[model samples]
Target: MRKKLLHIICLASMILLFSCSGDVTDELPALTRAQLSINLLNNGDVDQQEEINSIRFIVFGSTPGGVRLDVNEHILLSTPETATDIDAQLLKVTSSNDILVVVIANEPQSLTSKLDGIASHWTLQDMLYDISDILNSDGQIISTTGMPMIGVVRGISIAPDETQKVEMVIERAVARVDVFLEAIDGGAVTGYTAGSTSVTLHNLSHDSYFVMGNVGNGTRDNADSSKNYGKVKENVPEIDLLTDTWTAATSDTWAYSSATGAKNRRLLCSFYTAERIFKSDYSDRLAVSMAYVPKGPSDVTGITEKVIETITKVDDKGSPTAQPFTEIRRNNVYQITARVGKIGIQILTVTVEDWGDRQDIDLDMDL
Candidate 1:
């Protein structure tokens, strides 16, 4: 009887210990990480939208009102889906802390250094540091020859256990200038030949992160190919400018990125002569210049005079003001029409649009 009682008492003690352990385990909260769903956008612009193979994201933790993200720890995630999980330690936050993130897609693999390995948190200086490696072996800006369809989303807020949905509108970091040669009355251009005219946009900046419109050097309007300028050769599409009403700027395909489609020319943003005058020359501006003669019967000689026209900004009062013109903002379109006898080319208009369907980008067709 004594041995049996002792065994029962020992079993009772074991049950109490196990029950206490279960209670302690229940009291502790489960480990939770911040969940994020990243949705890439084409800014609703059909032209800028491309297929994203994958994306790289960096999450920085910052205390409320603090300028620097915690440099000691960070979360780096490369994902192929629109939604994924990020390490909690890199994004763990208290009530007053916020999260800052920078994401890029379709960028060059060599550009991995641009984010500095995603190991530590970033300071304002680190965040603003420019990547000098944006040049090729010949030192030409990489963005000019071939650029990644850069889509960046910055300054996001996240809380512990919060599932955040983000829209990262991605667009071409460049503007496409569609050059048109036609008669003043919207007739087919008879004199100029296709594949002959090389339009040049001069004095543009090549900085990697020059995201804003106003923060750059002044641009110059020039037509001379001998000087510094960006040129698009063999760019004019095959169209009967005289007969076909080629009024819309993007009526032709805009190959602004390399995303496995016919519209993936992936050129960098060049200096664009603005068609809108709403903002008084935001920063240093540039001009558009091209000189070409109409195709003649091989023997035609005295057509020595080339159409040389320079556009100057006319103010609200309609006067040509020479304050360095506006830098061509990225993802904009400058549609140009050069008439036979007109002194300066007529700007049908400059349009900033989102590429949606055929109708969305060509909304200016009515004008």
Candidate 2:
């Protein structure tokens, strides 16, 4: 599943500079300066379309080598955040005959280090890392957000003074998990007695790394395999479902992979049980057991306490047969569902849905 992503350029006009030959007459029409009308199609979480803080695009000389984002400010860049489309005008020059266009949207200023690291060879992994603990100065986890669509158009050349329309298709670099609580016959987790219980998906990956352009989805030089690129951070907080039928998912659970991987990643989750102590080694694939708090009916006086909680994992399509290991991919949504009751907890998997595309992941999940 280490797939190479191709950069799609909607439109682009390459410009070339040359020395003057003989004295030319005014018969030829005057050429306008190089300009670009950048059209940004909304990408990323459907709800995050309006969250764009700023947009930036860089122009570089087209070569076998790549360009850098933090290198020079004069390569012709723009930060037009308000428009679905932006017009950028560049100063005339003559060193290189071709250029590349890279547009990064909604990037956090905290990652400004990437500005200097942004180059043709750098992948999204090179420019970023995951923040599992969104903590305050006092060390309390905060609700932090992450996601940025990257678009790149390379090898673009324009006839002298001709304007080009480069359509850039930026794609999400990570996967999204949406937890849903499907209680049967008004169970304990049926939004009725949700206050007394807490549930969590274990082994959540906290870090990710990948290359860009036609390069592989993993490390640039297999740099992170042993360090193992991404892993679930220890002591990660549980996902509280609250009063709603679903867990409080203000944003994606984690931003890790953009497509299926050669590795088999599973979401080890527990039933809606009472709050339990959280501990685990980030490096282990299947670490400690999930948390579960068993409790009888709050109002029923004659009812006896419950025990023997059973947990079953189902296929991606919620089939009766559960997968030995649930496979995951990027730019997709995995809805891990739970049906709670006095008997036990059955975890069901809804079909995997790609963020911006309609084709669902085939249940085979074999890369």
Candidate 3:
């Protein structure tokens, strides 16, 4: 009986040992390191002029963990789309492990040019809605005139057991106003020349006049002959000359002294003789030319000139009509140049504001 009992105990011990060994083997496979990988592929042909129609990135693994993605963290290594072109596309990340960046080419038949149409598509509607709480409380127009304001998704997810990749794109929009100043020369007269000119602006709603300058004339000096003076010296009473309010005077000593007069003649003679008048029926039609100035990072190296339009009259309501001018929409980056011109002798003010969205991340992932 004792021998039989010991044999049974030995058999039971062996069975228990085999069961424990099997359990260990099963757990060993689970202990292996999980792998993470990401792959990027472009789905279109190389010759396609359509900007990147679609971009995809995939993550795969045997034991996948739900991945957290940050679209702002992903780097674009190579793209068919230029920085300016990226702003017109729609970006979508379909699945947790799969990312799809899509861009729809603007129809060639649109009223606006393809590039302009693309730029206009970068509307921050969603972003604006998200920040409505703060914006609604404020009364000021958030002047994002020339600013590059990009939108970003802080976090998103892919599959339950895969690495996550982010999705992103550029948003661009442009509001352009063109100005033209045509120099019209009136016949020359003694002591003065008549120059009738007009200003024209395109796509502009409202404008104000700050200063005016004579073409090629140095700074305004009433006593200097080299400078160009409107018709005050030649007219009998040149008080209402340049515009409706401007006039010339020979007897009014104050007016003659204040008007452009020779220094020696001003001291020797008590009054100024009327020469000729530079007359304009529309004071609001004054325009000036300025060297292209870039206030932002966009490359506007080749831009040469910009037209400035001014507002002439105000009705009972404050709405204004933009003076007539030509419009210029070139393919190159627009910049604000330092060299500026004027329509008269007054100082002009220029306002620079944000223009578009500029947000991107440089992501360096080993995978």
Using TM-score as the measure, the top candidate is 2
Residue-pair clashes per candidate, as listed?
Answer: 17, 16, 54
| Candidate lDDT (C-alpha), each | 0.32, 0.36, 0.21
Expressed as tens digits, the lDDT of each residue in 257-289 for candidate 1 is 224543221222222221222123332233344
Q: Model 3: per-residue lDDT, tens digit, 120-153?
A: 1122111111111111122111222111112212
Candidates ranked by TM-score, best first?
2, 1, 3
Candidate 1: stretches off by over 4 Å: 1-32, 41-48, 64-96, 118-157, 186-188, 194-196, 210-284, 295-324, 341-348, 354-367
- Cα lDDT over the full model 3: 0.21
In model 1, the Cα lDDT at residue 164 comes to: 46
**Model 3, total clashes:** 54
Ranking by lDDT: 2, 1, 3
What is the per-residue lDDT of model 2 for residues 131-158, given as tens digits with 9 covering 90 to 100?
2322233222221322444455554555
- TM, every model: 0.46, 0.50, 0.18
